[model samples]
Target: MAQRLLLRRFVSVTLRGSSGPVGSRSSARLPRLSSLSWHGTGPPSHHRAGPTAARGFCVSHASGGIFNVQDQADFTDRVINNEKPVLVDFHATWCAPCRVLGPRLEKMVAKQQGKIVMAKVDIDDHTDLALEYKVTVVPTVIAVKDGDIVDRFVGVKSEDDLEVFIKKLI
Candidate 1:
């Protein structure tokens, strides 16, 4: 089945770290998936000029951070379509709690490599998404099961609490 294949790919990508369409790197050295940001100067030459703020999300890899999709379409294809459950952090650039939770979530991503896919959305930049999900607070975490939000937590949660929540899901 497609789900089984996706699950296998997810496990392979996590464990072997060398099998996905995307190149692999040790989870330790890689920037947390959600830590990828683009606050730098003008757009790269490859891209046409545009409002810098409107540019898509950027994902930082070992080689360099590259532009990633900022829309829900791409996110669904890359994340929700995958077989593994996903943990999405809805955050904002200026929120203090979001900043505090960012790195912690990254650390969790590294530790739980194969088990879950961690993604982040900057609620400030993606207001529609935040509104659709009814995420009124910064640092709102939602767990997606088979592409549907099945669990959610607001505010900062300890690693133990997160772990316990995730364990219950699996």
Candidate 2:
């Protein structure tokens, strides 16, 4: 009876281990979100990967919104040549503050979809662009008009502040 009990305990432990950590079911599989690649040439299309029933990219902004630029070459065309005002967000994946500020920027983009364009450049992925913009910190947001940088915020700023900054351009 003792041997049987020991075997049952071992099986329970093994089953628990095979199932992921607590709270996750063994049969549960995480859905994969689409991978976005921004090469600085322009914002790539939002790609979603998952089960056919899964929702695809759900950017809340208006159409032609949410640009992800990857390289300096792409940045020039997208930001400099664009007719609308541009807000470039220099960020990195590992930055804690950047993560916090990201959603805020998204909301800002949705708020200013027609008046301004939003682009994100990952500093870790594009070091040269970060250096050119003098981005020493993550979550640096720069406002560009007619290819000239008119104003910039080094860290997270309130939406009101961003509004005032953009208002100056108008």
Candidate 3:
């Protein structure tokens, strides 16, 4: 019974706690946030937060939405050697901040058009990549170019702050 109560409390706190950008947006008023569910039963759609049916890719926001990095080789091909700068989001599905920051990031990156691209590495699925980056926390964003990390940030950042960071990379 206590375990069940603890679980309930967790859910409640999670629901009320920082959903990152969403929670911040809501602070101005009673924010009507849609359900923060990570999964859906329907087929994969570009509009949903799903990597399950992407064959590999996860959620893509705006034009620069999240791109999935399957392994080291994939990372090398897509991020390190790419002609354009790449912003890698080291995240997990269970991370509430990731959920909120991701879409907002997509929107921001989209504005950049071909200037840059975004890569997503699921820490749970790609443990090696996360460990190599020394990501002890979720929602870590890294900027890479020509096989080097140019810049990075940890945890939730305001849209303006993120935009400022992205400005440095691209």
**Using alpha carbons, what is the TM-score of model 3?**
0.64
Candidate 3, residues 1-170, lDDT tens digits: the string is 23433553454354454443323543324223212322233323232221222233455445544577878998888888888888999987768999998887777888886788889887766778887898988899999977799888899999999899989987
Model 3 residue 159 distance off true place after TM-score fit, in angstroms? 0.7
Q: What C-alpha lDDT values do all the predictions have?
A: 0.61, 0.63, 0.69
- Give the per-residue lDDT of model 1 (tens digit) for 73-93: 867775578577777788866
lDDT measured at residue 2 in model 1 versus the true structure, 0 to 100 = 33
Give me the candidate number with maximum TM-score.
Answer: 3
Give me the overall lDDT of model 3. 0.69
Error of 3 at 129 (Å): 0.2
Q: Model 2, which residues run further than 4 Å from truth? A: 1-62
Clash totals for all models, in order? 0, 6, 2
lDDT of 1 at 82: 59
Q: Which residue pairs show backbone clashes in model 1?
A: none
Decreasing lDDT order of the candidates: 3, 2, 1
Worst 10 residues of 2 by lDDT: 30-39
Worst 10 residues of 1 by lDDT: 45-54
